[model samples]
Target chain A: MKIKVLAFGKIADILPQQEWEMDGVVTTGMLRGQLEAKYPDLKGLRYLIAVDKKIANDDSPLEDRSEVALLPPFSGG
Target chain B: MEKQTVNTEEKPSHRRKKVFVEGPISPAFVGDSIAKHSTMMNIGAHSIFLGQVRKDVIEGQEVVAIEYSAYTEMAEEKFHEIREDTFAKYPLTCMHIYHSLGKVDAGEICLFVFTSAIHRREAIDACNEVVERIKQEVPVWGKEIFDNDQYVWKENK
Candidate 1:
């Protein structure tokens, strides 16, 4: 399966592209592992995974065309 | 013409108001917003929250400004949720929220939350709840820029 990945905040700095496509990721857990392996800097960062605009746990299932966002800690007032 | 007037009057409660501005929110704009509410005679109280960018020195470096960004789609959804939840929890007559994008200088306003109700308790409590939820739930991020051009991501405390 393929998914759309969106990166934000400090995570964007670690990931080369802010928005991109990824393949063969079926769950949020898989995506996290692949991302950390590909971008070592991501391993130490604190972030949350939002799938389809809702925060998702690592075991959350994903589908094709799903939009996944890596959100850093929120600071807005 | 009659239908249009009805729609105009009813849209505020139904439509999602635009919540993002390109830069700092000016005081004049805030004043204009308050002025527009004069015709809402039933509103007996209005609670307002303004968030200003503060200059904090870190590692001996003086902060100059903050550039904010967001996952806009998610942020909008979160804002809508907060609005709905607040309305359900309090007897508010109206609510307005705005947050800044791009660069905002120190002492400039970045967030504005206004809540109105028939009584002071509801409006004040609703406003406080909305602001608290915004800080914790919204996906907006602020990049604190230092005077030397260094920057760091701000995290909610």
Candidate 2:
């Protein structure tokens, strides 16, 4: 199964812009765990995941071709 | 029941203007905005919030300055949404919001929010809410420059 991940803000700067293919990962938490293995620096950083534009939690189900955007806490005023 | 006259007079005008500018935000421009929105019969109180950059030591590193960048297209759209939402939620006479893009030195103003209302309470509450919403929704990024010319991305807590 293949899922598209879009990283933004600080996380985007850290991760390479490329899609990853997972055989059996079906949840956002599992995808995050796979990402952690590649980028250990993101271990403690707080992040928000969105399926499309709406915010999604760790337990949110992921389809084989779903689009996900990872974002950090916003800072603007 | 005693018949009471309904004063069908039109409510006063409520104007809102928001801008996202490059480089520094001119005080003259900001002052002109306030002047243009002022009226003789209404607007008894005006509240303003100015956010300035501060130089501090973070993890034993001395910070020198900051560079700000925004998804301007999206930010403008978000600003309009915030303005309309604030107007709908509160009774405000007028509002103005402006933020600086590009490099800003320490102690320089980066964000400014001003609101006018008939009373002090509405002005204060509206000002706070608008600023908070902007911080939460806008896609603006800040890069902290260290004294040694190194940089780090800033994240909101």
Candidate 3:
């Protein structure tokens, strides 16, 4: 299935594009592995995976058209 | 009566209020917001929180401003969730939250939180909780811009 990924904060600095689509990813863990492998800088960076606007664990299932975002430590307010 | 209760319980989260401002929140705006609530006669107390950007010296560099950005779609969701939770936990008459989206200079207001209730404790506690949740949960980022044109990512401590 294809999923959309959005990057924010420090993670955005490493992503080639802030928003992009990836295919053949089955779970959040797989997605993270692929991203870190592609962008070595991501390996050491701390972030959370939010699937469809909700924070998801690594084993969370990814459906087609899921909106995945990489969120670094929040510093708002 | 059953349906009405359900409606009231669910409505707060469903209503998507605008929470992001393009730049720093103005004093006049905050004043107007407080003034507008005067019409609500039942509110006896109101707690307000204003967040200001600080001019911090880092590595001999001075921070001149902070540029904020967010995963807006997710942030709105998180804000709503926080609102719903607070409303459930407190008997607040009203609540409002606003955050700056772009560059905010040192000493400028970056976030505004207001909560009103029949008494002071609920209002004060709700305002504090909302502010804390926004700092730790919302997907908003602030990039500290130094006077030398360099920048660094900010993290909640």
Candidate 1 lDDT tens digits, B1-157: 1111111142236567678888888888788778778888898999999999998988888879999999999999899899988888898888888888889999999999988899999999999999999999999999999987889999999
Name the regions of candidate 3 deviating beyond 4 angstroms. Answer: B1-14
Root-mean-square deviation (CA) per prediction? 3.9, 9.1, 5.8
Q: Would you list the rank order by TM-score, best first?
A: 1, 3, 2
**Poorest stretch of ten by lDDT in candidate 1 chain B:** B1-10
Q: DockQ of candidates 1 onward, in order?
A: 0.93, 0.43, 0.89
- Calculate each model's fnat, 2 decimals: 0.92, 0.63, 0.96
Error of 1 at B50 (Å): 0.2
lDDT of 2 by residue, A2-75 (tens): 77776766777788763344566688898789889989978888887766455689989998877776767766
Candidate 1 chain B superposition, TM-score: 0.92
- The DockQ-based CAPRI class assigned to model 2 is acceptable
CAPRI-style class, candidate 3: high
Candidate 3 positional error at B49, Å:
0.4
Candidate 2: clashing pairs of residues: none
TM-score of 3: 0.93
User: Which regions of candidate 1 deviate over 4 angstroms?
Assistant: B1-12
TM values, all candidates:
0.94, 0.74, 0.93
Strongest candidate by lDDT: 3
Comparing 1 with 3 on DockQ, the higher-scoring candidate is: 1
Backbone collision count in every prediction? 0, 0, 0
> Who is ahead in TM-score, 1 or 2?
1
